[model samples]
Target: MDHRFEIFLACAPGLEAALASEAKGMGFGPLRPMAGGIAFDGTWRDVWRANLVLRGPARVLARIGGFPAVHLAQLDKRARRFAWGDVLRADQPVRVEATSLRSRIYHEGAIRGRIERAITEELGSPVADDGVRLLVRIEENLVSFSIDTSGGPLHRRGFKQAVGKAPMRETLAALFLRECGYRGTEPVLDPMCGSGTFVIEAAEIACGLAPGRARKFDFERLSGFDPQAWAQMKADAAPHPCDLRFYGSDRDAGAVRMATANAERAGVDHLARFECRSATAIERPDGPAGLVMINPPYGERIGKPGPLYGLHRDVGAALMERFRGWRVGVITTEAGLARATGLPFLPAGRPVAHGSLRVRLYQTGPL
Candidate 1:
C-alpha cells in the first residue's frame, strides 16, 4: 500500500501565492497555500520532481503528524505516543526544532527539550547536531510535526564551490528566473551575475536536469527507502544537451572567475558563457527574444542608501538603452531605488524575504 505523503515547499514570505500558481501550472494537484509555504499531496515521485523542477521552493518538508494538545503533559504524551519508530532510526541522530504561537505551552526550549527526551530516552536514540535526521514542529495549542526530507536545504546543490561577494542564493535565483518567465528556451542574461548561479541554473533547467541529481537527500537514509527505485529515478533524470541558453557578466573580475568556476563544477560550462564586463556590454544572441534578470546592489547589502538611488537610475538607463525588446525582472527592497529606475513597473507578485529585508520583484515589457 502506498503511504499518504504531505509535501510542503517552504518559501519566502508573501510569495506562497506565486509558488502555488507555478505549481498548479506545472500540473501539481491540490496545491494549498499556507503561511510561508504551499502544501500538496504526492508520492515519492512527486517529491523527487518538486526538488528537481521547482524554482521557488526554499526547502521541502514531509509532514509526519499533527495532533491537538492543550498542555505540556498532553504534548509530551501525544508526541511520545506518535509513531516515531516508523520514520526515525534508533541509531540515527536527530534534532527537534519547535515554534509556538498562542499556545498553552509557550516555552519553545521546554517543548524542544521534552520532545528530545521522549525520543532519546524512550526510543533509545540520541540527539545529533550533524549527520542525523531532524524533527520540525509548529505548535499552536496543537502540534504539527515533520521530518526534514531535503537534508541540508535544497539550495546547497553541491556544485557551487566558489562564490563571489554578496552572491545570490540558488533558490532565490531560480525563483527570479521563473518570475521573468524564463522557460529556459532562449538565452538568459545576468549582467550583474554574481557567481553565475542564475546562468548555471538556467542551463540545467533547459536541459531537463534535476537540481538534486548530484546531491544526497535525508530520505535516502530513512528506514524502508527503496534504493533501486531511487537509482532508476536518478538515472532517468540525467542531464542532456539541448541548447546553449545562458550568459552572465560582472565588472568584478573576481565575480566572473567565481561564476566560471561554479559553472564548471555544475558540469554546464559548455552551456554558459561568463565574462568580466559591465552591464552596458550586455547583448542578446542570435535567437528568439529572451529574458534578462538582475539583482543589483541594494543598500542593505552595499553602500549608503544615498548613492544607491543613482546607481539604480544608471542601471535603468543601461537596460532601457541596451535591452529594448527583452523581458526584464529586477529585485530590490528600496522603493526609492525602484522608482529611480524609471522602468514601468508591473507587479509579478508580493514582497518576499531576502534575508531580513522584505523585497519585491518589479518587471517590465518585451522592450
Candidate 2:
C-alpha cells in the first residue's frame, strides 16, 4: 500500500490564496495554490486530518496515480494494471468520470467506459451511479486519477440545517473570514446573518473545535481504512474553552431562531448568540471591537440593488455611528451596491464565484 498521497483542497476560484493561507496556518503544506484549489503532498493520515480540520475547502481529493495513455485501449490496460485493491474495495460499486483536455483521446465517454470495464473485470467492482466518484483527467496524452475523499462536501459540516435566502456556503464564509483577518481571537457579528454560518464557523474556530467533528465523510468507506485509528483521531479533537462570544443579528425573528438553532447544533451555542434586530437598530456590544462581516442581498437573489441602496446606506450609517473601531467586510455582487454602503471600503479581493454570479469581499480598516 502506497501511503503517500497528494491532497487537493477544492475551494472557490478566487479564494485560492485564502485557502492556501489557512493551509499554511495549519501547517498542512509547503503549499501550492492552483486555479480552483490547492494541493499538498502527505500521508493518508494527513488526508484524514485535512478532511477533519480544514474549514475552507468544498471537498478534499486524494490523487492516487497516473500514466500516459494516448488511446482508449492504453487507458483500459493501464487503469486495470494500476493499483485498485489498495484503496477501493472489490465488492463496492464505483463511479468513473473522465475529462479529456488537449489529448489524443478526445472521447470522454469511451475513456469512462474503458476505465469502468477495467474496474469491473479486473478489480471486480461494479460501476454504479451512486458509488464513490473517481475523477479521471487526460491532458495532452497523460491521464491522472484522483478519488473524491471528502465525500458530499466539506461545507455541509453536518450542522447547519437552516438556511435563509442567498445563504453563504460554510467554505466561502471561512475563506472570507480569513480574508478579513479573523483568526478566532475576537468576536464576529453579521447583521444580515443568513442561517448563522459565519457566527458558527467563528465560534468553532475560537473554541478550537474541528469543523468536521459532527459530520461523516466518504473516506470512511475506502479500503485499508482503520476505523479505530480514525475514531482515535477524532477523539483527540478536544475543544479548548474560549471566552469571546460570536454574535449575529437579523431583522426577522424567524432568522434569529434559525441562527440560534444552528449554533446549538454546532455545539457552539455557549459561544455564539443571535438576536432579532435590524442593522440600524444594532448597538455595539460591550466588548473590544472585532470584525463585522455581512453578506447582504445583492440583487442576484432577492431583487435589484436599486432598492438596496438605502439599506446599504443604513448599514453603513449604523456602523459609522455606533460601531466605531470595528473592521468590516461586505460581500455582494454589485460594486455599486458595495459602494452604496458609504463606508470607507478599501481595495476588495478578486470576485469569487458564489453561484451563477460572482461576488467580491469589500473590506475596511478599523472605524
Query: Which candidate achieves the best lDDT against the true structure?
Result: 2
Pairs in clash, predicted candidate 2:
none
List the candidates' TM-scores in order.
0.92, 0.98
Worst 10 residues of 2 by lDDT: 1-10
For model 1, how does the per-residue alpha-carbon lDDT over 223-310 read when each residue is reduced to its tens digit? 5677788888778777667766688899899999888999888888888889888776666667776788888888887667888787
* lDDT per residue (tens digit) for residues 1-367 in model 2: 3467788999989999999999898889989888899999988888888999899999999998999988777888888898888888887789999999999999989999998988889889888887889999999999999999887888898888988887889999999999999999999998888699999999999888998887887788789888999999899987898999889999988889989999999899988889998877888888999999998887777778688999998989999999889999999888998888899999989989997889999999999
lDDT (C-alpha) at residue 189 in model 1: 84
Clashing pairs in 1: 324-367, 325-366
Off by over 4 Å in 1: 25-27, 131-133, 136-140
Cα lDDT for residue 123, model 1? 79
Error of 2 at 63 (Å): 0.8
